[model samples]
Target: MKLSNEVKFNYPREDIWKALHDPEILKHAIPGCEGLTLQEDGSYDVSMSLGVAAVKGKYNGKVYMTDIEKPNKYLLEAEGSGSPGHVSMKMDCNLEETEEGCLLKWDCDAEIGGKIAGVGSRALGGIAKFMAKKFFDDIKKQLKKGAYTN
Candidate 1:
């Protein structure tokens, strides 16, 4: 599946970039995230429990950031599996400085298999969009509360 969206933050791109790489900030922004550990290779090992429609499971995943251009853009690669299924995604994120703060735009391609894929593309697409929105919403809240500031 393909997904794309944009979110505006009331902070500078540098601050937003720092927050994006912070495991503590991500653990709170990501839905159902239980733990997030940064690895030596700059990848993150993540564990979370998620429920989407009739599918519910615990997922363990690795997230890697590449092609990073600090405070501007990067690529994210992730893969995970659970009892319900497996999923992998690659996304490109761009940060644009705005008058108010910054704009984060993302485009992603994802693949799924097993019981989760059986849930139908329409349902999966909706769930993906919802989850993306929720993630950004959580980030917005954290930023507003100064949870990610240095």
Candidate 2:
């Protein structure tokens, strides 16, 4: 599946970029995130329990940030598996400075297999979108709470 979106933040682009990489901020923002730990290689080990729609599962995954352009863009590659099934995804994120703050544009390509796929693509698409939006919105909230102060 392919998904994309744009989000505007009232904060500076730099702060938004940094906040995206901050483990604490992500854990606080990501819905159902139980843990987010940074690895020595710079990837993040993430654990999440999602209870939304037909995609409910406890997932353990590694998210790698690559092709990074500081304060501008990056790519996220992640793979995870649980009782529901397995998922692998690659997402590209871009940020543009706006007069108000920053404009974040992101797109993702995902492959899902197992029981989750049996739920049908339409339903899964909606669930994916819901989770993604909640994540971005929560990031904004975390930023507002001064989670990304330098």
Candidate 3:
């Protein structure tokens, strides 16, 4: 599946970039995310429960950030598994400063296997896109509320 979205945050680009690197901010932004731990070597362990549109399950995943250009762009690769199936996804992200705030552009590709693949691929894409938008909106709100103190 391929997904893309653009969101504008009501903060400076630097602050938004910092929030993106903060585990706490990430945990809060992801729907049903229970916890996020940032390991010393640029790896992250994430625990999350997902019940979006057509799929419901708990996932434990590791994400690695690469091709990072701090405060500007990066690539994220992640994989997770659950009783229903497994998910592997990759995303390329770009951030640009706007007079009002910052504009974020995200492009992603994902694949599902096992039971989750039984759901229609088109339906799955829609569901995943919705979830992604929700996640970004959550992050924007948190930043607006001064939730990321760091």
Candidate 4:
């Protein structure tokens, strides 16, 4: 699957970048995130629980950031497994100053196998898009509030 989105945040690019790298902020912004731990070498370990139309489960995953260009751009790659399936994705994220604050653009490609794929591709795409939108919206709200707690 392929996903793309653009989000406008109420915070400066630097602040948004900081929040993006912060495990605390990520745990809050990500849907169903139970825990996120930062590791050495700019990697992260994450756990989340999610239930789509027909696929429901908890996923434990590892993510790493690479090709970073300071506060401007980076590449993120992540993969996770649940009881019945697993998903792996790679995304490129770019940030820039906008009239409102910061503009973030991301393009992602994902591969899924096992039971989750049994739910059907179209349904999964819809669910993933909804979840991604919600995540970005939450981030925008958090930025507006200066910080998000718990």
Candidate 5:
């Protein structure tokens, strides 16, 4: 599946970039996130529980950030598995400074297998979009409240 979207934040691009790299900020920003640990190799080990449509399970994943150009763009590659199925995604994220604040744009390619894939692509796509929106919204709220300090 392919997913793309953009989100605007009321904070500076540098601040947003710092928040994005912070595991504590991400644990709160990500929906259903239970834990996030940054590895020595710069990847993150994540644990999350999610329920979407007919799929519900706890997932353990490793997220790798690559091609980083600091406060500009990067690639996120993740792979996870649970009792329901397995999922892998590669997302390219871009941060653009705007007059008001900043805009975060992302495009993702994802693959799924097992029971979750049986739920149909349309349903899976909708679930993915919803989750992404929630994540961004949480981040925006945290930023507005000065939840992260530089």
Candidate 6:
């Protein structure tokens, strides 16, 4: 599946970039994240427990940030598996500076296999979008509360 979205942030691009990379902030924003550890190799180890309908399960995965352009853009790649199924995604994330703050945009390509894939593409698409929105909203709330992850 492929999905795209843009979120407006009332914070500076630099600040948004920092928040996105901060492990604590990411752990807080990721809907079901149990742990987010930054590895010395610049990758992240993630553990998540999700109870969302047919996709409910505990997942462990590694995420890699590549093609980084500092406070501008980067590629996020992740793959995880659980009792329900397996999922992998590659998302291009961009942060553009705007007059008010920052405009964060992302385009993602994802693949799923096993029981989870049985949920149908349309349903999965909606779920992915919902999860994405929650993630961004959580970040926005943190920024507003001055919860600087770094």
Provide the lDDT at 100 for model 6.
Answer: 93
- Give the local distance difference test score of model 5: 0.91
Among all windows of 10 consecutive residues in model 3, the one with the lowest summed lDDT is 141-150
Displacement of the residue 122 alpha carbon in candidate 2, Å: 0.5
Instruction: Report the candidate with higher lDDT, 4 versus 5.
Output: 5
Q: What would the per-residue lDDT of candidate 4 be over residues 1-150, giving only the tens digit for each residue? A: 999988888677888888888888788999999999998777999999988676789999999999999899999999999986999999999999987678999999999998998988898999999999988887777766767322
lDDT of 5 at 141: 81
lDDT of every predicted structure (CA atoms): 0.92, 0.89, 0.86, 0.89, 0.91, 0.92
TM-score between model 2 and native: 0.94
In model 3, residue pairs whose N, Cα or C atoms come closer than 3 Å (at least 3 residues apart or on different chains), thus clashing, are none
Stretches of candidate 2 off by over 4 Å are 52-55
What's the distance in Å from true for residue 127, model 2?
0.9
Give the distance in Å from residue 24's predicted Cα in candidate 1 to where it truly belongs. Answer: 0.3
Cα lDDT of model 5 by residue, 15-118, tens digit:
88988898988999898999999999999999989876778999999999999999899999999989889999999999999998889999999999988999
Judge candidate 2 at residue 98 and give its lDDT: 100
What's model 1's lDDT at 46?
96
Q: Model 6, range 27-127, lDDT digits (tens) per residue?
A: 99999999999999999999999865656899999999999999899999999999988999999999999999999999999999888899899988998
Give a tens-digit lDDT track for model 3, residues 41-92: 9899998887745668888989999999988999999998887788899999
Score candidate 5 by TM-score against the native. Answer: 0.96
Model 2 pairs in collision: none
> Residue 108 lDDT in model 2?
94
What lDDT is reached at residue 116 by model 4?
A: 90
On the 0 to 100 scale, the lDDT of residue 85 in model 3 is 86
lDDT of 5 at 100: 85
Residue 99 displacement (Å), model 1: 0.5
- Candidate 1's residue-wise lDDT over 94-136, tens digit each? 9999999999999999999989899999999999999999998
